[model samples]
Target: MRKLIFALAPVIAMGGITLAVAQNATTATREVYVKARPTDVLSSNLIGLNVHNNAKENVGEIKDLIVSSSGQLSGFIVSVGGFLGIGERYVVVAPSALKVTYSENDKKWSATMDTTKDALKAAPEFKYEGRWSK
Candidate 1:
């Protein structure tokens, strides 16, 4: 019985180590986001969402996004002007230009830009093409 217990001790320790290693591996690839209070949002949910400035001025809405082949977000196409998007035009801005945050007080997601509506309207139009990435 002593010999059997000694042999089983090594196997039990090995099994415990294996279980710990498997748990670590599973967590390594997992993405963690705070539930219900997230300041982050998926791009699909952000499309056509209203954007405002710091002073709570309505600016424009996000129209489209440009993504790199390496899966990096390159630019955002913001549509400005028009009523209810009737005559809205598209302008390109770097992804860094917009700040996305959830307002705890407002209980909503907000997108803010440094520039104003008029300036955004004056920005050069961005036309999407297959060769734009090239």
Candidate 2:
């Protein structure tokens, strides 16, 4: 009926306006083009990389990376004291604690930490439960 159409007109117009605004906002914020710089290392490359201490002793391996809601690197999850996925403990290390480097000639990437294997094992463990569980 005409009365019904009149009642819904404002709502429909508001929806259309809201949709247009959302589209424009998305376009403005979205990255349409991106390039990988030489200094940047992919997360896929870092994950599973073995971490060693200053003396080159095996400490742990990077299992996962924690990212904040604001798209910031929060922590690196390292698995320590594990043999073939058996008795490993997971610990969240600070982003600055692990040093990552790339070698062009060797075509390899390496990660190093200042702590030892026993130190990492003694640190607080992070269980992949609750929100972190698959």
Candidate 3:
């Protein structure tokens, strides 16, 4: 029994080391980004931003962003036809629909769409429920 215990000790220690190496291999598979590109815009700066039309009319306010599982931007939730949040409803728009720009002189970000407030209000509304619940 003493000899058997001594024989298993090295195997048990090797198993623990193998388990640790496996854990490190799993961790290394996840990608890590260390630097931000110039085109990257912080999501914190986008929320609550007023969306305007080409005619300089405020169409909607950016309420939320939808990100896909593949790490891509899926949609932008815009609130339209709201009077101090009383009658507002959320509408999901494609990220390409909004023309987002940054002005170097004013150091401000602006978003514009070739649409009107009435057009946005007439769009299909998105309700916060289930997976998108507030």
- For each of the candidates, the C-alpha root-mean-square deviation to the true structure, in angstroms, is 15.0, 13.1, 14.9
TM-score of candidate 2 against the unseen true structure: 0.78
Pick the winner on TM-score between candidates 1 and 2: 2
Kindly give the stretch of ten consecutive residues in candidate 1 with the minimal lDDT sum.
Answer: 12-21
> Which should have the higher lDDT, number 2 or number 3?
2
Clashing pairs in 2: none
Please write out the lDDT profile of model 3 over residues 28-67, one tens digit for every residue.
3532223444555667767988999988999999999776
| Top of the candidates by TM-score | 2
- lDDT value, residue 6 of candidate 1: 12
Candidate ranking under lDDT, highest first, comes to 2, 3, 1
Whichever of 1 and 2 has more lDDT, that candidate is 2
Higher lDDT: candidate 1 or 3?
A: 3
lDDT of each: 0.61, 0.70, 0.68
| TM accuracy, model 3 | 0.76
Clashing pairs in 3: none
How many steric overlaps are in each model, in order? 0, 0, 0
Better-scoring candidate (TM-score), 1 or 3: 3
| Model 1 clashing residue pairs (backbone) | none
